[model samples]
Target: MIKGIYVHIPFCHQICSYCDFNKFYFHNQPVDAYLDRLDQEMEHWSRKTDLSEVHTVFLGGGTPTSLSLRQLSKLFDSLEQHFPIHQITEFTSEANPDELTYDKMELMAARGVNRFSIGVQTFDARLLKVLGRTHTEQHVERVIQHANDLKFPSISMDLMYGLPNQTMDHWKDALHRAFQMPITHISAYSLIVEPKTIFYNLMSKGKLPLPAQDLERDMYDYLLTSTKKHDFEQYEISNFAKNGLYSKHNSIYWKNEEYLGLGAGAHGYVDGIRYSNHGPLKKYMSALEEGNLPIIHQNFVTEKEAMEEELFLGLRMNKGVSFSDFKRKYGNDLREIYQSQLSKQIQLGNLEERDGRLQLTYQGRFIGNDVFSEFLL
Candidate 1:
C-alpha cells in the first residue's frame, strides 16, 4: 500500500535564524494564491497515480498552522473531491505554538486531523529571541493542553539543543516542560548552523559563542538518559515517542517505502522514481495554473541504490533491521553486501549481528552517521 503522503506549506509567520526550510515570510498575496495551486496540483496528481492506497497524510511546513481555517478547509475539501481520504490513518499538521488557537485546533479535529506537532524550540524567552521564534513557553503549554482537550490522538513537541548560552539545567527544564503535557512524542535536535541560516552569518562574524564539542555531546547524552528514564523510546535519531505513537508518515521515509508528495518543494518516491516539486511559489503556481506537473527533477533508483538506502534508513530504528526481511526484499544476503564494513565494525565493537537481527552497538549508535556513511553508494 502507498503508506505516506507529504504536503509542504511554504509560508511562515517569520523566518527563524536557525531555519533554512523552503519558506517565505507570510504574505496575503502569496499564501492565498499558493493554496489555490496546491488544490489544483492535488487534483491533477490524483489522476496521475492510483492514490487509493495512501494510508497517512502529513501536512508539514514552513508552518501549516499559519493557514486560516478557511484555507485549510478548502485544501481538505479539494482532496475529498478526488479521493476516499477517510481511510488515511494518521493525518498530521505541523504547528507553531503562536499560530495554534482553540478554534484552529477544533476545526482541524473536525476535519480528521488527529495529530499535531508543535514547534516548541525552547521555553526560554531570551533563547527564543536569539532563535527568532515568535512563541513563548507559556504558548507551548497552552497549545498542548488545548490539543489534549480536543482529544488529538497524538501530540508532539520539537526541542533543540547546542544553542548559544544554553546549559544542562536549561535543557533539563525544557524536557520537564515536555512531560507536563499529554504529548506522545518529542523530537530534540542539535543546532547545526547551516551556511544559509542567520546563525551561520553570526558565526562567520565570530559573534556567536557556540557550545564546545564536549558540551554538545553532553547535551545529546543527557537527552538520551532522560528520555529513557521517562519511558520515551528513542526510536530514531533525535526522536522519542511513546509506544505505538511513532510518526507513521515519518516511518515511511526511514523505511524507504513508496509515498507521494504534493505542493511546493515537496519530495517523494514511488515505483522507483523519485522527484521534487519546484520550490518557488510563483514557479509552482504558474506551472499548476498551466496544468503542468511542477516536478523539477527526478532520479530512477537503481537496485543497488535502493538496497543501500534500505540498509541506511532501517538501522535508524532501535529494533534494527531483520536479516530475513532484508534478504526477502533484496534477494541477496545482507552479510555479503556489507561484509567488509560489518567485519570491521564488529572487530571494533561498534556493530553486531545476533539471532537474525543486524544493528549497531551502543558505541556504534553514537557514531551512526559514520556507519550509515559506509553504505552511501
Candidate 2:
C-alpha cells in the first residue's frame, strides 16, 4: 500500500552551493501555472489509486516556504481536494529559516501542517555564507520561536558537518546552538559533493577544502554522544528524535515502502514498479496539460531486487531488519539467501543479530555504505 505522499516544491529564493535538487529561482517563474498543473496531476492520480491509505504527507523543496501565502493556500486546497488531509497523521513541510515567516507558518498550521523541517546547516555565520545560505542565526531562532508559539507538533532542524574549513570547534558551536532551541528533532549529515553542485565544481578545481576522513568520523561521533546526552534517541544513523517525534515521512523511504511522489523530478514506488517523473518543468507540465501522468522512467522491481533493497535500506535504522518480516515478505529464510555475505560482515564485527533482527554494529555505521554494498547481489 502507498502509505506516504511526497509533494515537491521546486522553488528557492536562494540556491545553496551544495544542493543539487531540482529547483528554480522563485522570481519570475510560472509559479502559479506549475501549481495548477500539480493540481491536475493530483486529480489524475486520485482517480487511479486510493490515497486514503496515505497517512504521511511531506512537502519538500527547493524550499516549500518560498511560496507566497496565496500560493500555499492554493496548493493546500488542491491537496485537500484529492487526498484526505484531515486524516493524515503527519504532515511536514521543509522551510528555509529566513523565508518561513510567522504568517506563512500560521497558514501551514491552519491547513494541517503539523511539522516543520528547517534548514539550519550550521550556526556559524562564516560557514553559512560558504554554504550559500542567506539565513542568519537570528532567522533560525525566530522561526523556531514562531513554530513553538504556534504549538506545532514537531519541529526538526537539519545540520551539516565535514564542511569546508570547518573545525571541531565550529561543529561543537553549531550543535550547542542547536540544542539551545526547543526543537524536537535533529538530522546531522556529512557533506558529499555531488556532481553538478557548486561544491563539486569547486572541489574539481581544488578550491574546496573538506575535513579529513578521521576528523569527519570524529565529528559524527560527537554528534551521537551529544544528542544522546540531550535526551534524544538515535532512531536512524543520522536522525535523532525527542519525545518519539520521529519523521514518519522519511521512515517510509528507509523501510523501502511504496509512496506517491508528485511534482517534477519526483520518484515513486507503487504496485511493484519504481518510477520517476520528468525532471524539467516544461516536460512535466506539457504531459499533464495533455492529460498524461508525466512519468519519464519506470522499471518493474524483481523479487531479487526487492530483497536486495530490503537489506540495504532497512539496515539504516537502529531497529534494523527483522528476520521474520523478511521471510513473510519473500518466503525465503534470511540466512539462506545471503549466508556468505552475512557471515563475512558478522566476522568482521560490522553486523550483529539481536532479537531475530540483523543490524549494523557501531563500527559498521561509520562505514555504512561499504557494509550496505556487500549485500548487493
Candidate 2 versus truth, CA RMSD in Å, comes to 0.6
Candidate 2: segments with Cα more than 4 A from true spot: none
lDDT of 2 by residue, 202-268 (tens): 9999999999999999999999999999998998999999999999999999999999999999999
lDDT: worst 10-residue window of model 2? 44-53
Alpha carbon lDDT at 260, candidate 1: 85
**Residue 305 Cα positional deviation in candidate 1, in Å, after optimal superposition:** 0.8
User: Candidate 1: TM-score?
Assistant: 0.97
Each candidate structure's TM-score, on Cα atoms with residue i matched to residue i, is 0.97, 0.99
Which stretches of model 1 miss by more than 4 angstroms? Answer: none
Total backbone clashes of candidate 1, pairs 3 or more residues apart or in separate chains: 0
